[model samples]
Target: MDPGEPDPEPGRIEVLRRRLAQRHGERLFAEGALGPRRDLAGVLAYVLALLVHGVTVALVVAGLLLVVLGWGQGALPVIGGLLLGFAVVLRPRFGRLPDDTPVLRRAEAPQLFALIDEVAAVAGTTGVDAVVVAADANASVTTYGIRQRRMLHIGLGYWEILTPQQRIALLGHELGHFANGDTRRTAVIWNALHSLALWHYFLAPVPEPDLVERITNWVMTPPRWAVYGLLHLLDQLTLRSTQRAEYLADEASARVGSTDAAAELMDRMLVLDSVEVALQRESVIAQTKGGAGTRRETEQGLWERLAARVESVSEREYERLRRVSVLRGHSADATHPPTHLRRRRVSEGEQWQAAVRYDEERAHAIAAELAAARDRVARVVISDTAC
Candidate 1:
């Protein structure tokens, strides 16, 4: 997708919510709101989230009661069994960790983990359980499984382009999500959204030729629309808080890495298109020069070359990208405030001295730890491009 384009997957309801969110986000910033807060909107968000969850819970309980009451009976037991089975479909889904990504362990990357620990301390969040490297030009922190174990995903494309301080800023921003109190990320609220989404998915009308199937779809349509409406309401209620959390995360980035570094990081985000082009160019060059060279020879210093390409971006080019962002209202996504606003806010916020610093020696050690992962990611990039 283009930088400023609305995400296609969200469809119409989310598009409306995004517009409302953008308006509310601008007002929040204008009013100098600092971080997530428990206002009237927040209370409504929680109530709506609980109400969604409560519906599922009530259905399950009713199913279980029917099963018990109808034991050894005929139709009631069968009906209860069906209800229980349907309730299972409404259960919360805790996503699994990526099987294909390179999982970096603390033992394998001590220095890197140490840096993460320091950043977490400064950001006032617990450290991540693991780090995973991917091929995308983005980084994020997410929870997985019932334990909600934290995983930090680093995109080599994004990671390689950042300077050490900027990297710290990036980490600060991601880890800050945990501390920022974004209601959407909370298990109660998130699971409610998940359950409602499942309802929408299962009840959605589909083309069916069989008479019975057509009737079933017809029966399900009303409930499907109802779920859709509830989902829209929950989303709208939480939208402001979600956007506020992002600004708070940006604040954490500034507090941990210093305001200047965080601001520079936002500037770097504006030029991610250049990062992608550089990655593709390097991949193509590697393929062209791959006659008799060994794998190591082809992949060695791949990240360094990419970093150099990013560093070589002229000030004039950076300014041009900034202008384009403003013109386009470019953001990471519809949910996020515009990139230019985030950059401006960070720059204009209180100046903070670096709370966590990485000197040259430590930075080199951390890079050394990432060597194997870097080679693996570089090979993947080349192979993907080849395909």
Candidate 2:
């Protein structure tokens, strides 16, 4: 490297980061071996996360001490107050579920809830408190509020395309997050990371539209970069553990949904782009219909049509997608390990027979329960596409 050469762009740096993370992950989980041990790197990451939270607590304590000791001093009281206010403003938050999310209660979707419960039990986790449907081609399990009530978010765009067994695999994988030793998901670590992220966001420089704003940004730049570096360090420390959690989640998926089904789910993930395209096409077609009544009628069968389109995806196309995934080192996201690695790992282990099973009758009953959510999601998709 030349001394005078500029540093890589942020996008290039991120790509390099991901590549390094992936290499570390591949080395950690060689040949799909699942050992019951935490590596030194994972332990260090966990300790660092704890230390971050401890620092926050220390800050609060120091602020209080300053307020008490400097009761009569003008400058000291103001400094103490500023510190207290900063702590309050940057406090860790338990995020709320979006109001627009189409949530399904157990009472309204007993059959669906039952299936999820069975999958949860098989995956060694408890049943979710609520199930929400969305329009993206993804699914996840998360906790909400101080109570940490569990919630499952299923993307209709993805769910509508999967086989019944694949759906069970998806549920098992998500519920597995609870059982997996995913340090990042733990309250202490998650909140610490969240607070740091918030600090980074607040400290970041905005567009300098005026001299005063420019000065403020210039003053803020050093602290912003400091926070950015810290965040990246923490992320690097936890990268391997996070990736390991994903593989463990895949194992859970296989345990409850069978290895074949779980592997098929990975293949499905590889072609999610095609799924998105089909969904957009459907949305556009619905919008093109002459009247609101016609569009609504089309929306009602949207899921069925989408399902058929996905089902119609040929083996040749699937193979092509798999090859593409391999070539591109495709992953669900930067946080996840590569798709091909996950797929290979799940299949390499002793083929897991499903502990839980799904039948057409049960599948139908679950779909019946999700009917309202499907319609609502369809409407949302169409509305967004029209706009």
Candidate 3:
């Protein structure tokens, strides 16, 4: 399947969910919980603050102009306030206090750096300068490369939702992004040309619902249509860049983790989309994939395969991620990319068990060690007499 293209597999999700539920609990997505990143939160605050301030200032300017037309200064305040509210619905505000969550790198957890280093080794890439877990569940590998800035940001949502193995799988994907250098900042030049064309050509809002007013409106709204049209056009032109990048990332994931690990993650996301679509289907938007049961399970995995493929993460880790993978909510409000989608694309599915060479002995060792670590963390949390 082309990367990013939708090819919903049949019966795969239900089975995966069952498999995960049996091993781990369901993924929990509590409302108002931290799933979006803090940068977005800060970005929104700063950006919207500027937009609002701009609109407020603009309204003051507009109102003063109105005063020259004989509208009293007394009426200006009310007019300015209403204009500010109206501006809220204008072009997508890049600033909104993203969901609140603490930074992971700065968290009290001592194991973060070691975990990052371990991931870098597994991924065959140098470790990042720092690592952080955002309040959100999303994770990203961002870098433009060579003297350009490169950084990986993982949302707390993934940390919360994934088991250690899944987390390992996820980290592989992001590091792949860093390793692959997914930043398209270089595309800015082309994008600028596109925007210039849009500004001169189609950069006008729909002027006519019908007739002359629509034409007039289209002619009048330059900034709005310029921004909106450029965005729409980029989705079409840049999609190939995006798809290819995603494919590369998936390949990176396969190299770092077993192909099957990637496959399981994909299946996990397929289940998430299925469940979400199921809910939306019932919720009246009614957008759900029809036709279940007749589909064949061609993707990969059938229990034993999953065991060998997921060896990087302990069985315990799989159980933990599966338990939490039952994450819910739309990705609309998300600052982080959807794990369901990223993991699936990165799976690059091809039977991987043949190559995994599982160590049942090591699994046992890691399980015992991790169990002890959990107990120690619990003790630390509990012994804190200071609330």
Best by lDDT: 1
Q: How high a TM-score does candidate 1 get?
A: 0.84
| Better candidate number, 2 or 3, judged by lDDT | 2
TM-score of each: 0.84, 0.85, 0.41
Judging by TM-score against the true structure, name the best candidate: 2
Residue 124 of model 2 has an lDDT of 85
Q: Give candidate 1's root-mean-square deviation (CA, Å).
A: 3.8
As a TM-score, model 3 comes out at 0.41
**Whole-structure CA lDDT of model 2:** 0.81
Alpha-carbon deviation at 146 in model 3, angstroms: 15
lDDT-wise, the better of 1 and 2 is 1
User: Which regions of candidate 3 are displaced past 4 Å?
Assistant: 1-99, 106-110, 121-124, 129-137, 142-152, 183-216, 221-237, 273-387
Instruction: List model 2 lDDT by residue over 281-354, tens digit each.
Output: 76777777757886788777777887888888888877887777767667887678888888888888769988
Pick the winner on TM-score between candidates 1 and 2. 2
Question: What local lDDT score does residue 349 receive in model 2, on the 0 to 100 scale?
Answer: 79
Compared with the true structure, all predictions reach lDDT values of 0.82, 0.81, 0.41
Against the true structure, candidate 2 reaches a TM-score of 0.85
Model 3 residue 355 CA deviation (Å) reads 11
Tens-digit lDDT track of model 3 for 139-222? 665433344444556543233334445555666667755554322323332333333333434444463367776877766686
